[model samples]
Target: MTTRPGRGRPKASDGADRRTALVDAARRLFAERGFAATSVRAVAREAGVDAALVSHYFGDKQGLLVATMALPVDPAARIREVLDGGRDGLGERLVRTFTETWDPHEDVIAALLRTAMTGDPEQAPALQLARAVLVVGVREQLQGPDADGRAALVAAQVVGLAVTRYVARLPHVRDLTPGDLARVYGPAVQALVDGN
Candidate 1:
């Protein structure tokens, strides 16, 4: 009798599956141990893959952080889109873009927000990832004095809006449609962006 192909390990075609496994593993570890505490080797072990595979797929821990968050849209691309039309309506554009991007992923966002609110040092990576996406875009687009402060203010406004609407599930804010939200909240964001 001829020996058959061995079933020792998964075939190379399972690359996509492996990537998914890594992301799932990262999410779990990040949630359980926080980003700072979770090592690449640990993530790889959790995924049952070689550490090199994590590097090959995610480049590093930060890359894995992005993947684990599963953001609905690419933050940089969305930022560029919001900034493309100039700063005339930047606040409204930002509000609309952010709410729209997150509306479909409320569950994911809420979970992340809860994890971040835990005040665990391990959660710093997740918080940093959130800040990088939200604040970096604002800082990049803003001009004039105290750009950093302005960006922080703008980030606070948008993040607060998300917390109320999504995480807190505030009935009044949650009831408003996206367009209504843009109309209601845009001016506040605009003021911050305009440095008024």
Candidate 2:
């Protein structure tokens, strides 16, 4: 007699599918139940995988939350890349980065932005993920007494750009090319970074 498929921990070839299942489950539950209310065990059950896989794949619930964002590139790593380019044209770089990262994944990122806009950051996983991914990521990479303030300001700019351009799909902002938007918005972000 032969056993059925997908009844246990997936084989190496199935790893990607297993991971996708967990992310899909987490995304659905996070939307329906809210992030804080969802549990790793519930996600595992929803995905039809062992609870240990969540820990193995994501390190924790917070990591799973970040994974749900599902951008093609890693946000923190990309943030570091821009930060490495230094303060010169940093604002343009930031605008370019934000647009490039979210443009292809507007539906996913827009949902995250709405969660942030409507939910309390303290209780919302999506907002916490935003702070941890963008705000804290930026803050940790900079120096000086104003680093925290600068990071928060930059985060605000990035968030506004996301809401207006992606979520709201504003005609003027959404119609511009990434390069064009960077040129228009970068100076303001750069000003914040330069503490002007």
Candidate 3:
């Protein structure tokens, strides 16, 4: 016969709206607390849902971090597309996509990047997580003994440009259009991608 319920976890209210809420909550917490300091349970609590739902929806904290990242497109996929068209203008493609995608969203990207790269003792963990999430794919695509080094070199070019243009707002770089920036910055990135 039917018996009354004892202590059990509540049914997860899973759906698009719930996922969006969790993402929104996660974005806030991640930005406010930094990725290393934020937890899955904290995101669930912020979203007003059971902790299990965070795992159910996002797999884990890293998964949640992926979902909440500010980049509007997959940087890896964009790189793949640039690679697909061959190496002739590869640098331009890479730089163009980066400039176009990151220009309008510079403020948000700048804050996240600044926090991660500040070199403050308190910011080290965030730096590690940022390095993992942001450019791991570039490492894989390089696909060689020194893939990580190559990818890191590529990242340095892009991140340096982003910081000088967007965060620091330097005179010449800030004055340059995306096309102009791509023309200037693309070849260096291509060199790294080519292992040159």
TM values, all candidates? 0.61, 0.59, 0.52
Models, CA RMSD each:
7.0, 6.7, 9.1
TM-score quality measure for candidate 3: 0.52
RMSD of 3: 9.1
- The lDDT values for all models are 0.77, 0.77, 0.69
After best superposition, candidate 3 residue 127: deviation in angstroms? 7.7
TM-score ranking of the models: 1, 2, 3
Model 2 agreement with the true structure over 1-196: per-residue lDDT tens digits: 1222555655665445878889988877776566777888999889877888899999988889878865565667777787778767888998998788778776677657765665566534545655677776667666777988998989989888888887788988888888888999989998887777
lDDT of 1: 0.77
Ranking by lDDT: 2, 1, 3
Q: Runs in model 1 with CA error above 4 Å?
A: 1-69, 119-126
Across 1-196, the per-residue lDDT of candidate 1 in tens digits comes to 2222334555565544768888888877776666677899999888777778777888877778777777665656776688777778888888888788878877566657766776454644656765777687678878899999999998899789988987778997888888888898999999988888
* Clash counts for the predictions, in order: 0, 0, 0
Best by TM-score: 1
lDDT of 3 by residue, 1-196 (tens): 2121334553454223668888888777766666777788888777776778788887887677667655665555555666577646767787888788777766556556655654354534544554565466566656556878888877788778888887788999988888997888888787887787
**Quality of model 3 by C-alpha lDDT:** 0.69
